[model samples]
Target: MKFSAERATLLKALAHIQSVAEKRNTIPILANVLIHAADGQLSLKATDMEIEVVEVIPATIKREGATTAPAAVLYEIVRKLPDNVLVELDQADGDTPLQLRADRYATRLNVLSVDDFPSMGAGELPCRFKLNAGVLRSLIDRTRFAISTEETRYYLNGIFFHAADADGVPLLRAVATDGHRLARVETDLPEGAAEMPGVIIPRKTVAELRKLIDEAPEEIEVALSETRVQFTAGSIMLTSKLIDGTFPEYDRVIPRNNNRILRVGKKDFSDAVARVAAISQERSRPVKLTLEPGLLTLSASSPEQGVAKEELDDNRISYDAESLEIGFQARYLNDITDQVEKEVEFAFSDSAAPTIVRDVDSPSALYVLMPMRV
Candidate 1:
C-alpha cells in the first residue's frame, strides 16, 4: 500500500478516528487502526467493538492496498510532524511493516493483516434524517448533565431520545435523569424522523457525538436502526450500538399541578445557591430555599462548619400556602440553572413535593428537582 497526504489533512483524520480505539486491549488488532488507500483517498478506521469511527481524507495514491498500524503511536508521530509537509506511506508486502516517511524522518511501523480487523457491517437503517448542528448541540448540552452515572441501572445512564407530541405538534425530545434531578428538552422533529424508534444512546456515544457537533456543521446526517445508530459529518462517520434496555416512563415523574410560582433571574439564583452551599457539609451539601410572597431566601447550615444565608427580592414570587421551606442538593440546582437562559420559573406544590423549573423565554426545556428533608 502506498499513499501520500498533507500533514494537516492526515493529522485531522487521525485525531477523529484514533479516539475510538481503546488504549489498553487484550487483543492486539483491537488496539490498531486500519488504513486503506484506494482511489485517491485514504480511509482510517478505529473501533473498540462497541463504537467505531471512520474518517476519509483526500490523498495521492500510487498503489491501492491496506495495512494496520498502532493508532496512538501513529497519531503522535503525525501530530509532531512539520506543518504542510507531505507524508508518504508505503507497504511493499502484506506481512512486512509499513514505511512512514516525512521529510527527513523515516520509520517502519509494525503492521497486522487488515483482514483481522473486525467488520461492523452497515445494516439497513430504516430511519434516516437530517438535523441542524446547532439544534443537536443544544439538545445534548441542555440534558446531558442529568444523565445517571450508575452502572447498575444501565438504562438510566444515557439520554432517552424519541419523537413526541407537545400541544398537538410533533417534536423530538431528549430526557435524562439521575433520580435527584431530571432534564428534558425538545426541538422540532426533522422531516424524516417520524418513523425513528426511541433509542437510549449510551453516555460514551453521546460524548463522542457532542465532539463532532461542537464545530457546528451546517447539518448532520443521521441513520438509525433498532440496535444501532450512525452519524455522518462531512467525510467522518460514527457508528455506535444502542443500549439494549428500556427507559423508564419519565412523564409520571414530572409535576403537573405545582402552581406555587417563583420567578427569579437565572444568574442570581445560581450565584446565591453556590454561595450558601459553600458552608454546607461535603457529603450532602444541602441548601434550604424559603419562599414567601415577594422574597426568596437561600440558607445552608453545617454543625461542623458554619451557616450561610442570602435573600433575593423576586417580585413575581407568589404562593398561597404558608411560607414553604424546601431542602435540595446545591450542586443539582446549579446544574439545572446553569443551562437556563434569562429568567427561571419554579413551581412547587409543597415542601415535600418535586419542584419544577423552566426557562420563561424557552418553554421547550424543563427540569424537575425532588426536595430533600434537611
Candidate 2:
C-alpha cells in the first residue's frame, strides 16, 4: 500500500484506532492495525476481539493496496513527526516491511498478513436513532462513575440503556450501580427508538465511545441489535459486543418515602466532607453526618489520625427534619456530588436506610447511596 497523509490528520486518526488494540495479545495480527489505501482515503482499523474501531482520513493515494503494521509503533512515529509535515507510507506486498517517511526521519515497521485480522461485524442492527452530542455526554458523565468494577457480577459492569415511560412521556434512561450506590439519568426518547431492546454496554466500550464523542459533530448516529452496538461519528466508526446478561430491576432499590429533606449548597457540602474525611486512614474513609432542624455536622475519626469535624448552620443549609445521624464513604459521596450544579437535595428516612440524592436544578438525574456504620 502507498499513501501520503498530513501528519496532524493521520496522528489524530491513529490515536483513536491504536487505543482499541490491546497492549498484550496472544495473536500477532490482533496487535497490528490494518491499513488500506484506496479512492483518495486511508482507512485504519484496530480491534481487540470484543471492540473494534475504524477511522478514515483523506490522503494522497499513490497505489490501491492494503497491509498490516504495528499500531503502537506507527502511532509513535507519526506523533513525533513535525507538525504540518506530510507522512508517506509504502509497502510492496504483504511479505515486505512497511516504510514510513516524514521529512528527515524514516523507519520500517514489520508487516503482518492483512487477511489474518478478524472482523466484528455489526450484524443486522434493527434499532437506529440519532442523539445530540451534548445530550449523550450528559447521560454518560452522570452515571458512569457508579458502574461496577466487580468481575463476578459481569452484568453490572456497564451502563444499562433502555426506553421507559416517565408518567405518560417516553424517555431513554441510563442506569449504573455497584451495589453500594446507583445513578439513573434520562433524556427525551429520540425518533425510531421506541421499540429498542435494553442493552448493557461494556465499561471499556463506554469509555472509548465517550472519548471519540468529545470532539464529534453535533449529532451522532447510533445503531444497535440485541448482541452488538455501533456508533458512527463523522469519519470514525466503533462496533462493540454487548454484555449478554439481564440487568436487575433497579427501581426496587430507590427510596420512595424518605420524607426528611435537606437542601444545601453543593460547594459547602463537598468542601466540608473533604475536610473531615482527610483525618481518616481507612480504605472506606467513612464520614458521619449529624443533622438537626437547622444545622448539619460532618465528622470523621481514626485511631491513628484522630478526629476532625465541620459544621454548616441554617444560613448555608435548609433542613427542617428531626435530628438524624448517618455515615457514608467520603469517596462515594464526592463522586455523586461532582455531577451536581449549584445546590444538592438529600432525602433521609433513617440512619440505616438508603438515602436519595439529587441536583436541585436537574430533575432528570437521581442518585441513591447506602449508609455505613460510623
Local distance difference test, each candidate: 0.90, 0.94
lDDT of 2: 0.94
Candidate 1 shows a clash count of 0
lDDT by residue (229-324, candidate 2, tens digit) is 999999999999999999999999998999999999999999999999989767697899999999999999999979999999999999998999
- Return the top candidate by lDDT: 2
Query: In model 1, what are the clashing residue pairs, if there are any?
Result: none
Model 2 worst lDDT run, 10 consecutive residues: 277-286
Q: Give lDDT tens digits, candidate 1, residues 32-149.
A: 9999999889999999888899988899999999999999999999999999899999999899999999999999999888899998765888999999999999999999999999
Model 1, stretches more than 4 Å misplaced? 281-283, 315-322
TM-score of every model?
0.95, 0.99
